[model samples]
Structures are given as structure tokens and as C-alpha cells.
Target: MEKTTRAAFAFLLAACAPGVFAASSADLSVTGSITPSSCIPTLSNDGVIDHGKLTAKDLGRVTPTLLDLAEIQLEVICEGATVFTLTTFDNRAGTSAINPAHHGLGMINDDQKLGSVAFTLFEPVADAVPVKTIVSRSGGARWAENAYLGHEALTSFAAADGPNTPIAIEVLNARLRAFTIIVPARDLTVLDEVPIDGQATLQLKYW
Candidate 1:
């Protein structure tokens, strides 16, 4: 009887090993785009305007003016990995990304609130100094407008919690590469003359 029981147990173990001890596989590929869907206009402090809206024409020969990139960003956070990229009005660039900062490490920013991840430059561009730019809506009141620099004090945005909400990635480096701006709403007209509130979008995708 003992020999019979032993043989039965051995047979069961051999049968289970192949199915239970099999190697697993995973496809660790995440994909998305940095689509900033909001924008508004504000006056540059040094400019002649003190308490009025900034116009597109007011922005001199600088191809990319202040009112131009009010909604641009440099870093965007998503599941599995993070991304950062530059934005320009002349070209409609989409989803063209660079290598992951921390790939395969499963680095995910659980923090819902997002801070400025791009660094700022101090070079003078066509007479424009490397000062701070304030972000605000013109219609009602600025929801939250602060300078966007890694080291500077800036307002943070809330996370989406779900898959739909916009998720922004944390900036490992404190450097602003190129310029970014956003109009948070649909109406570009309001962003035209007065400091009225409007909505557009901006995001700094990883390139």
C-alpha cells in the first residue's frame, strides 16, 4: 500500500510541475501623446502693458511670442514610464518620443500633484531677457498663474487618478530646453484683445 501511494504522489507532482512552474512573459510597451488642451493670454511684466492683455502682434519679431506658447510644457507622465519633449507652432508634431529616462525600472509617479519639470535659460533672445512668465486665464480670473521653472516656485496640477485625466511626469532635471505655452479653452478670440479667461491646451512631450 505504501509503495502504491508513493508512486501516485510522484505522478501528480510531475504532472503539476510543467503547468505550474512555467516561465511567464510580458510586453512592457506603453504609448501615448502629450496633448495640452488649454491656453490663455497674459502681459509680460517688462512690456509696456501694466494691467491689460498681451496681443499676438504685441509680441515682436520673435517667431514664437509670449502669447504664442502660453500652454506649452516639457514633461508628461503616463503609466509604466515617463516622457518629455519640445513644442512649436510652426510644426504639428505628435508622439515622436525619446528613450525613457528610467526604463524598465517601473518608475511611476504616484503623486497626483505635478510641478514644473523644465529648466529655464538665461540667454537673451532678440532683446527678451530670461525672466519668469506668469500663467493665467483672462476672462474671470487666473485659475493659477505662476512662473514655470524647475527651481522657481510654481503651482502644481492635480493628477487624473483614472486613465482619462491628464497625467504629467516629474522632471528629473531642472532645465527648460525650449519655450512652451497653452490655451486651455476652445476660443482663441478671447485670448486676442482683453485679459478675458479662455481655455486651450499645452504639454511638453518627451522627444
Candidate 2:
């Protein structure tokens, strides 16, 4: 298995004011882990969802269009049990929104925003036991009862089969839904053939 490595950047921001020139600051912390445990990740349909060909007439001018919902089976199996969460690194940065719900589709000519894509996680099975997507705002103290596919924060996670904490189960299989949309015609004028490229990297984070 390959080694997983990561680095974090922290920043302190202070609010500036004239009358009350007091320093009000907050800590920006990034944390991740590289564990000895390793997992094999796989996606359904050989990880390919082809839309075939498209023309300007297929897209909209004022309003963006949505492609049909695509389903993919996501499975991960570790050599041994380990606790981890999947963190997504959007490859097409600067072309999408900062909101965790959206990831940028590749741009046209490296300028115009092409569109966006989002993934939702569901129907999870861990080590033959049913699993739910749960988040802990209090750092693993409590977790959500139900898990919905949405943009989970870096601090959020999917709970274990029967515990508040996420356990490193031997195998995890889940259904994933991906949403793809096209940018408004006003922004993206596909004068020529352009590739609908959207990429993201998902790394397992050890808690």
C-alpha cells in the first residue's frame, strides 16, 4: 500500500475597528492523519459516466441544465480495521463555489466557468452491518441519527455501524449519487468541442 501524507495550515484573523481596536481572533486549524492501515477504493461502472456528445442546442442560454442523476457504487476495503473519513480535494479549483455542496467542472479556455458537480453518499454497509452517515459537532461526542448525502465538512464524518465513533471496518460499500450541470450559456459559449471534465481526489482521513 502507498503511504498517505498530509500537511495543515493555520491562520489567525483579527477584526479591526477604530473605536474598539481590540484584537478579536479565531483559530483556523487543518488536521489530518496518515495511518498504517490501507484501503482499496473502487467506483461503479469502471468509474465512467459518459454523456456521449453535446451541442450548443442541448444547453440552455439563460438557465443552466441538469443531467440525469447518475448512480455509482463506492466500495473501500482496508487491509485491517481502521477509522477514517473521505476528504475530497477538488482538482478544478477557482472555477467553482467554496460551498462544500459544489465542485467545479473544468472551465472553457481556462477562463469561463463550465459548470458544477456534487456527490451524495447513501446506503452504506460496513462489515456486513448497515451504516449511517452521522456528523459530530462536538468532536465524536454525539452523532446525527440519519445520514444524508450532502456536502460534509472536513470535521464531519460517517458514524460506525453501532457506535458514535467510526470504526475501521474491514469493508464498506455505499451508493453514491452524482449531479452534473452546465453553466448558463451566457457564461460558457462552447464555440468548439470542449471536454466535460470534472475531477476530485478523495483521501481517507484517520481520526
- Across residues 85-171, which tens digit of lDDT does each residue of candidate 2 receive? 665677787666323457787778767888888777777888887777665545456666544333344322344535555666678
Instruction: Write the residue-wise lDDT of candidate 1 on 106-194 in tens digits.
Output: 11132111111122322211112221233223321342323333311222232212221122343221222323222222212332233
> Which stretch of 10 consecutive residues in model 1 shows the poorest summed lDDT?
99-108
Per-model lDDT: 0.29, 0.68
Candidate 2 contains a number of clashing pairs equal to: 1
In terms of TM-score, how similar is model 2 to the real structure?
A: 0.69
Off by over 4 Å in 1: 1-76, 88-200
TM-scores for candidates 1 onward, in order: 0.17, 0.69
Worst 10 residues of 2 by lDDT: 5-14
RMSD of each predicted structure = 20.0, 11.8
